[model samples]
Target: MNDLPFLQHFIVLPVLLPLLAGALLIPVKQSRYSLKFACSVTSTILLWVLAAVLLAMADGGYWPDGIGVYLASNWAAPFGIALLVDRLTALMLLLTATIALAVLVFSARRWDRVGIQFHTLFQFLLMGLNGAFLTNDLFNLFVFFEVMLAASYGLVLHGYNLHRIRAGMQYIAINLVASFMFLIGVALIYAASGTLNLTDLGARVALLGNEDTWLLSIGVCVLGLAFLTKGAMWPLGFWLPGTYASASAPVAAMLVLMTKVGVYAVLRVWLAVFGNDAGALAGFGFTALTIGGMATLFFGAIGMLASQDGGRMAGYGAIISSGTLLAVIGQAGGPVLASGLYYLLGSTLAMAAFMLLVELTERIRPPGAALIAITMEAFAIEDKPEDPVGQGIPGTLAFLGLSFAACALVISGMPPLSGFVAKFSLFHALLEVSPTEGKVPGLTWGFIALVIVGGLAAIIALMRLGVRIFWASGDIAPPRLQFSEAAPVTALVALCVMLTLQAGTVFDYLDRTVAGLAQVTTYSERVLGEPPVMRSPQRGLER
Candidate 1:
């Protein structure tokens, strides 16, 4: 381990770098917008680089157990705070950094200038995201969750537009409730298990008596609800579309990962603390998760079809991705879970790019034309000659149209894109499990149907929107494209394409990640410095 003492320190940098950067930018005057922008861009790029290195180090070839634990102040687990850098955590950090960097680059054009302290809030958001992904204790997770949410509150309302403020209020209200529930759940878990360290909690869970088990189960349910709310699972996610649509393009893009953080928390806590070894607690909320995920999928699909606004459609797409991941995870199959991870990555990139592309496309269209056209189409009215005509640079229309089409294909999971590969991989994984072996459950068919039908719904919605904006109406002008704005979208889409090109390598890494998640013994030994104790047979629990 001492062979790379520096890597141990790298684990904390994802949190510390952003924290310090955000704090330092707070005192900078508005006149130094250039300085703030430069600092934010540099910090995000460096964070992405650092995350990439950490991910590489944590890969199974370098760290076969897939854990790189860091104890602050040289402390040990279950007593002091720990920063665990497993493959999953490292992957999340990398994803966060990648999206942050792209969003920051996209924001540099003008969005950052619309509001003061934008850079500071953005950095704080990164700090919170990194902290949440890295923290090993439940209380610290709450702390980081709050940090992320607080920064998001500012970002959602950054421009202070009337619509943004209205949506931000609703977003803030919902998340506050979720936070309260999270606190209550954490308190209950700590009360029942006498610990909040995840690995320690896992070790202790199997040994809990009937009463403690009952309390812990309640705590787990409450915690899952909190996470599901943040994940935008159906009923709890009503605020997501409005909130995302109201934010600035880059801010909306960064907000894509916020839902994923909730999903990550559920996956981490469920598998680590209440996995198969938790006896009666085993598969505690699988039924709820599976059903809720399907419901979320159905809701998002319908929402996407109903959405006239591009940003809102992207929001629904995110919800659909979250639902897909949640349902796959609930199934508890290795190959399917791995495919879900891939799907999560692809969908997030595509959604972020879509959010950015929405603004660019909207810039080229005549103001109010989209809404008017949608209304007219809904009412089956003919277009009037007096309708506004869009005007702009010659090639801008084609560029915007192509970018919009690419985003549409991606969001709709169409062919020759990363989205298609991701969905195909997921479907393939699900089908690979033999019905003869009884691994194919009833929910499997439901999940498969949702995945297929949701994609079809997205395709229809996007095509309709695209045709109205690009071809059906003559109210579009060429949009003015800047390198700062255009490059990020291009880069994001390119990254997705890269994922498709390198699907084999990416799937291999995901397979290793899934294997690492199943290594309960290795994880327990690493975190606790000893093997986990088995429950007594008289306790009516089995591993």
Candidate 2:
């Protein structure tokens, strides 16, 4: 085994480096070169840490130790702070890091235009993201969440506009409430289980029978609500669209990764501490997940239709996609697992591209506008009369159209796209559920609705917005697209293309990832006993 000291360094560096860099950036904010170099270096180092940790995991031959390295004091877990990395956590960490780097690069010009402080917030936000992914304790999770939220508050209001301030406040307030509930839920879980180490909680949960089950169930339900709110599930995600729409492009891109953290936590907590515990809580099962997922889908689709702004519409569509992924998890068996993970990958890539598009189109004038607004100080031109002969359609509009089309293909689950691959696995998994297994009735109908409505909503919404924004007779002119902005969006689209071209390879990787999920006993075995034998193949599958 690798030395514990080395692992501790790996576990802590990703979080600490960003915080240190962010603190250092505050003093040098006046230097543009320093700000740019600092953000780039911080992001690169974090990515390197992510790669190093994954490499270490591989070298160790996939250590399933539920509790990873402890703190400087080397205190025992549940009593001392520690970091944990499992397959799900690792996946999310890499996802956050990759997206973080992309967003930082996308924001280079915006940082130069606005202020260097945005990078400061971005780095701090990343610190929080990394902390959240790595922490083994629930309370630590809440702390990291607050760190992220604090950073987000500044970033959301970076432009210091009326709409942004209002949106940012609402977002912050809503999350604050969720944060409180999150802490309360953690306390309740700790009280009921007498430990906060997630791995230990799983073990304790397996020991608990029907005696204190009601309390356990309620605790899980409360925790689930907090996570769902973060995940942007229906009813609780009311603030997501408005806030995301109002935020700057780079900020919006980073925000998208936050929801995935919530989802990852939900999945981990659900499987670990409350796996199929029928006696624990009422209304806290796959059935609830299915119901919630469906509700989120309906609400998101409606919200998307109601939206006039393309950014807000895309935000709602993101919520809709999240709901679908969660719902598939509820129907978990085989294909559902495959679909949920695969769909997430697809959506992450697409959302990054769409966020860039939204930024590019936010300022373009109509077909007859005579000049461009150079900065917030130039906003007086909002009332300027257009030179009817001089204005022409903005090239940025064409870029938006292309981006929206790409998003449509992914979100709608069109063929030869990552989204399609994800949905196909999920729908097939649902269909493959044996009727004899006593599954809920009309499951297939639910899956059918998911594919049909999700596809239609994505397509119709994209078409409507594209036509109004890009081709309508009175549509606004597109904004200027800089190389910095265009490059990231193009690279993201290229990733989508690569995903499409290498569909088989992507699916295979997804299968491996899901397979990692299947080996839940691996963690427990490392802690308590020999690992359980996994069946080589399912009886339901034919040769």
Candidate 3:
């Protein structure tokens, strides 16, 4: 297929459109809610459409190695800013746009009115996310990261309640420290390698001497710490539940993708720069990642079991997903990485849907129900007052209940859903140990046990919470739910069902994505506009 003029510019639009729209929105009167909604929705829909087209083109083999590299301002890479789109990048963009559209639609129903500049902040957030996914330069990655963080600060504090304020403060402080570390890491990398372009850094990293290699490793480790913090891995993740639970539902749903940005960064930078082609630097942090990932999984599992609040349970679910991806990616094996990609998609969708459902379910709960339930349990009251036995469940309550159950199934990795398929694929990949690709020491068994236990923990947590929310409460009036509110949650859950039906096709695409990611040579050549000088031929994990 010939290169279309507009398609050539498609890569930039994801970042540019949102930025322009957000800036344009700043001057608009706050009273013009309809205009703001129209503009935000239009931009998000366009982004989704553009992302879909880009994904198709990249996956359909429109460019070399399924990569579409766009140099900003016609300047070449490693000197000028570059936007590189491959299958993985396109997939992230699509996820971001899809979720953004859903959350925006949900917010428009009423949540947008609670906060000033909600629409504008949302667009800026999209711009940041798209830029982070698309940028090939490290500095630009930092810029986009800050943009994302900045917008998140506003959204987190949206509605301005005491709980939101407290959570937002903690969120801001921790991330500010992370931002500092990120800047330090970027400076160290640039100082050592004389380049900030990811592919150029990848190429140059291969030729580093022992001293330079150690320095770069330090820098990478620092950078990894920052990503880990943002990804909410283990100890760094304590703040996520509170922050997420405090945000309004739409904002909380959108925040599901925030951790993914960190995961994507780790995957992109680690594979491209310190991959096997990095010679002595190969497998620099592999052990740490493996151990850390397992620990994260365990931590998230414990948190899930301990959490009484539904929002916090969903937060732990996100942590568990992040841990699973980290472990698989740490192994650096193609099949496992492919499986991780699938799990990433399924878990993210489930968590987003779960977040939305949390709000809807909570709305229907009787006032002071938690306190009342605690008192009843404390007193060992067996015969609580029961509502009329034959009363039919309200339509809204029934819908929320069904949606809540489906989300629980997905999050718990129950059978006959995408979550089950994802977990099964991951476990299968982990067990398929090959002679050429040795397993991480002590990782195989531990990871398997952790995954199973985590699933069980999630099941227990979700079921307990579900029973409390749905059955234990008595004679509660159903909250009025708008179709707009319910529609997005239903759509997200239905997408998970669709993912189950199309698992085979999705896995095939992921296989291709993993293959492309493993090709350090092709990635470097395409991004740097030159072949790397010190390419290594070794493959698979090194002992």
lDDT digits (tens) for residues 309-338 of candidate 2: 767987887888778767776765655676
Q: Measured by TM-score, how close is model 3 to the native structure?
A: 0.92
- List candidate 2 stretches off by more than 4 Å: 3-8, 31-37, 45-49, 52-72, 112-116, 209-211, 276-284, 367-400, 437-440, 473-479, 527-543
The lDDT leader among the candidates is 3
What's the distance in Å from true for residue 249, model 1? Answer: 0.8
lDDT of 2: 0.70
Which 10-residue window in model 3 sums to the lowest lDDT?
381-390
Name the regions of candidate 3 deviating beyond 4 angstroms.
Answer: 1-3, 368-394, 434-441, 530-543
Clash total of candidate 3: 0
Q: Each model's TM-score, in the order given?
A: 0.92, 0.85, 0.92
lDDT of each: 0.84, 0.70, 0.85
Q: What is the C-alpha RMSD of each candidate to the true structure, in Å?
A: 7.5, 7.9, 7.8
lDDT score for residue 32 of model 1: 82
lDDT of 1 by residue, 1-543 (tens): 445545568989999999999999999997787999999989998999989988988984555477887777666678888888888888988999888988988777477876679899999999999999999899999999999999999888876756777788999999999999999999999889999999889888989999999899999889888998999998988989998888888889988999999999998888887678877787777777878889999999999999998889999989988888899878777898898898888889889988988887776577676578557545543211121233444577776777777777777789888788888888888888737565676777888899888999999999988887788767554666667777788888888889889999999999989988977767877876622224486864222
Better model by lDDT, 1 or 2? Answer: 1
